[model samples]
Structure formats: structure tokens, C-alpha cells
Target: MRAVIGIGNPGRNYIGTRHNVGFYILDSFAHKNKLDFLPTKSDFWKAESVIDTFRFLLIKPTTYVNNSGLVINELIDNFNLTMNDLLVIYDDVNLDIGNIRIRKNGSDGGHNGIKSIIYHLQSDSFPRIRVGVGKQKDDESLANYVLSKFNKDEINLIDQKIPLLEQLMIEFIANGYEKMLDYFSKESNTNSSNLS
Candidate 1:
């Protein structure tokens, strides 16, 4: 069993913020694949899909971003899955816009949602895809920055990268983490800026 969780705040107010990029990416990916998400009993919206024999769950937490662990842990327990069975995707302000990084495991790097997941799982061994939301300007506070929406130019940049990102999400589901390291590394980061 496999699961992908996209962390973001739930509500119409947060719909277009940079912090919701995870949800944006996952929603678009699911849509492109013709999958529909069904709201579950818990604080999650879920859809199931398959690529060949690989069965995977696509989930977006309906909980606020900081409390995301509750949704993750619930799905983990209900599915009887290990950390290796999960892949998390979220926004990262540390990298430039449209950049993405994939890693097998690491510390949360000060992201509250990641920190909450680490706390609930008591481990940091899960795979993750970090989508860059770009660094905040010096004048903006971190909270204000993340909760802010992308500007028109930034959204256009991300729009250009969507197909590649959707492909990456599909590849992650089909290949797991190891098979595509080079495909998503910094060298490929440059390619994300261009559409094929």
C-alpha cells in the first residue's frame, strides 16, 4: 500500500496561497490523471488510483497545515503502512520558485507540518518532495509570506512547470524514490523552468 499526502491549510481563504502549493500540485496531478477526490470521515480528502499494479492513495489533509500529522498518522494506521509506504509533498520557501527537491529522509527544516509528522510517527524516514515557493522578501514575516498568494508572474512561472511536476508525481508513484533521483536533482531543476 502507498500514500501521498499534500500538506496545506483547509478552507477557501487559503486556496491560492503559496502555502497551499502542495495541495495545488496534487490536485492538478490527480485531475490530469482523471481521478476524483472523495472527502473522507476524517480531516482528509482522498482518491485512489493505480499505475499498472501499483495501488496508491492520494490525500489532502483537511486539517490546518500545523496539525497535518493527525491526518497522516490516521491514514498510516488505517492502511497498516510503514513510513516507507508514504511520500509527502509540500512547499519550501528555501529554494527559488519552481524548484523541487526529492529526498528519502531528513529533518523537518523548521516546517511545522513536517515537524508534526515527525512527532507523530517518531521517525523521519519517509520520502518527501519539496516544491519551491521561493524565499520571502526581507520585509515580510515568514507566516505572512507563506500564507500569501503567488503573484501573477510567479503563478505563470508555475503554470509553465505544471506538466513536468505532474509527470514527476506520476513517476514517484510508479518508481518509488530511488529510481528517479537524477531525474529530479538540481540539474533537472533547470529543466523545470522550460516546457518540453
Candidate 2:
């Protein structure tokens, strides 16, 4: 079984904010699949689904982003899930708007949510997808920028990208990270060649 955890603060106030893109992706995916997130006694809302016979869990921690790891640690223990069976999705200030970067394992890159995960897990050997929310302006504080909502154009761009992001998540579930990476890379090359 695989678990996909989207990192974001829980509550209506956080909706549509840059920091909540992780939750946004999971919500969109669940809606598309006709699944509903059921509240757990634990610190998360979970939706379970089977795609192409692969069982996976969609998780949204009820805890705030900075403490996301608490939920993950609990999940790992209770569900018997290893780090390799997990995929974390979160926002990144370092990436340009609507861009995504996937990695098999790495440091948190100063993301508080990721830092918490690493702190609790005691390891970073897991797959992750980072959604880009764009860099903050020089004068804008990091907290302010991340918590801010996207403008009209930015929202449009994000909406356009959601379909592909959904495809990537599906790919991740149907195949492991290495296979997913290679498959998407080849698909990208094929599309580029066709365009050329």
C-alpha cells in the first residue's frame, strides 16, 4: 500500500492560500475520483482508493503545516508504512509559480513542514513532490507571501497545471517513484519532440 500525504494547515481560513496547494491537489484528486475525505480520530482526514488494483491512502493532516510530521509519524506506525511507501506533497518558495519538482530523497530545504517530518521520521529517504508558489518579493516576509492567495492569473495557471499534477499522482500510485520518474521523463520528451 502507498500513502500520499499533502502538507498544509487545516481550516477554512487557509483555503486557496499559497501554502495550501498541497491540500488543494489532494482535494482536486479526491473530487475527480469521487472520493470523500473522512475525518479520523487521529490528526488527519483520509480518503482511501484503489487505482489499477493498487491500494493507496490520500491523507491531509489536521495539524498545521509546521507540525505535519506528527500525523505522518503516527501513520507510519499505525499503518505499518515505511518511508519508501510514502509520498509527500508540499509547496516550495524556491520554485517558480506552477512549477513542480520531484525527488526521491533530500533535505527539507528550510520548509518548516518538511523539517518537522524529517525531525519525526529521523530520515529523508522518501519521495516528494514540491509545488511551486513563486518566490516572495524582497520586501515581503516569507510567512506573509506563503499565506497569501494567488492573483487571478496565478490561479488560472495553477488550475491549468492541476490536471497534469493529478496525472503525476496517479502515475506515482500505479508505479513506484523510479518508474514514475522515468515514465514522465519519457512522456515529456515525447511531447517535446512532437512539438518540435
Candidate 3:
């Protein structure tokens, strides 16, 4: 079993903020696969779907971003899953907009959600997919910047990128991380030539 946990604040107020891109990506994946993420008794919006032999649990925590670990830790313990079986997808302000980085393990790098997960899991060995939200100008407050919605131009780019992310998730589950990385790393060139 594998778990794909997308971290973000839960509420209508946070609907389209950069911080909620993780939820958007996961929602896209679930929608593409015909999976419904109805709320469960565990206080998470979750859905079960299988890609080949891998059974995946797609989770969006209702505990909000800062307290995300509460639900994640519960899922980990209840499922008896190891760190390797988990893949987190979240926004990263440090990365350039529209870029993504996949890592097997790493520190939270100042993400409150990731920090909470690390605190609860007591380890930093889980795999993660970091989606770039871009850094704010020096004059902008980090909180305000992250909570802001994307501009029309940025939305157009994100519209294209989301499907690619959905494909990557499918490939990551069906094949493995390396193959998914290879495909996504060269996505621009492939897309230019009309190849998926």
C-alpha cells in the first residue's frame, strides 16, 4: 500500500492560494482516476484507488496545514506503513515557479506542514514531491504572499502543469520514482514535440 498525502489548509478561504496547490494536484489526480474523496470518520477527505498492483490512499487532511501531522501520523499507524511507503506533495516557495523536485528524504526547509510531519513521524526519510510556488518580492510578507491567489497567467501555466503532475503520480505508482523523475525532468522538451 502507498499513501499520497497532499498538505494544505482546509477551508473555502484557502481554496486557490499557492499553499493549496498540493490539494489541487491531489484533487486532479483523484478526479482523473474517477475516485471520490468523501470525508471519512477519521477527519480526513480520503479515497481509495488502485493503479496496477499498488493500492493508493489519497489524503487531504482536515486538520489544516500547520497541524497536518495529526492526521498523517494516524494514517501511518493505522495502515502500518513505513516511511518509504509515503509520498508527500506540497508547495515550495524556495523553488522557481512551475518547477518540481522529487527527493527520497530531506528536512522540512521551513515548511510548517512538513515540520509538523517530521515532528510526528520522528523521521525525515519519506519521499516527497515539491511543487514550486515561487518566492515573493522582498516587500511582501511570506504569509500574505503564500495565501494569495495566482494571477491569470500563472493559472494558465498551472492548468497545463496539473495534468502532467497527475501523469507523474500514475507513473510513480505504476513504475517507480526514478522513472517518474526522468519523465518529469524532461517534460518541457517532450511536450514541445507533442509527446507525453
Q: Which model scores highest in TM-score?
A: 2
How many residue pairs collide in each prediction? 0, 0, 0
TM-score of each: 0.91, 0.94, 0.90
- lDDT of residue 13 for candidate 1: 92
Compared with the true structure, all predictions reach lDDT values of 0.83, 0.88, 0.83
Could you tell me the lDDT of residue 60 within candidate 1?
A: 93
**Which runs of model 1 end up more than 4 angstroms from their true locations?**
185-196
TM-score, model 1 to reference:
0.91
Per-residue lDDT over 1-196 for candidate 3, one digit per residue giving the tens place of the 0 to 100 score:
8788998888899988899888989988887789998898896899897887888889999988888888877887888877777788998899766677788778999899999999888888887888888899999999998899888887666666777788878777776677777877688565662222
Which pairs of residues clash in candidate 1, taking residues 3 or more apart in a chain or in different chains?
A: none
Q: After superposing candidate 2, which stretches have Cα over 4 Å from the reference?
A: 191-196
Give me the candidate number with maximum lDDT: 2
* Candidate RMSDs in order: 2.5, 2.5, 2.8
Model 3 off-target regions past 4 Å?
185-196
> Considering lDDT, which of the candidate structures 2 and 3 is the better prediction for this target?
2
lDDT, candidate 2, 51-143, per-residue tens:
999999999998899999998878988888889889898999998787777888889998999999998989888899888889999999999
In candidate 1, what are the lDDT values of residues 1-196, reduced to their tens digit? 7888998998899988988988998888888889999998998999998888888899999878898898877898898877877889898899788777788888998899999999888889999888888998899999999999999999877777777677666676788767556556644756535221
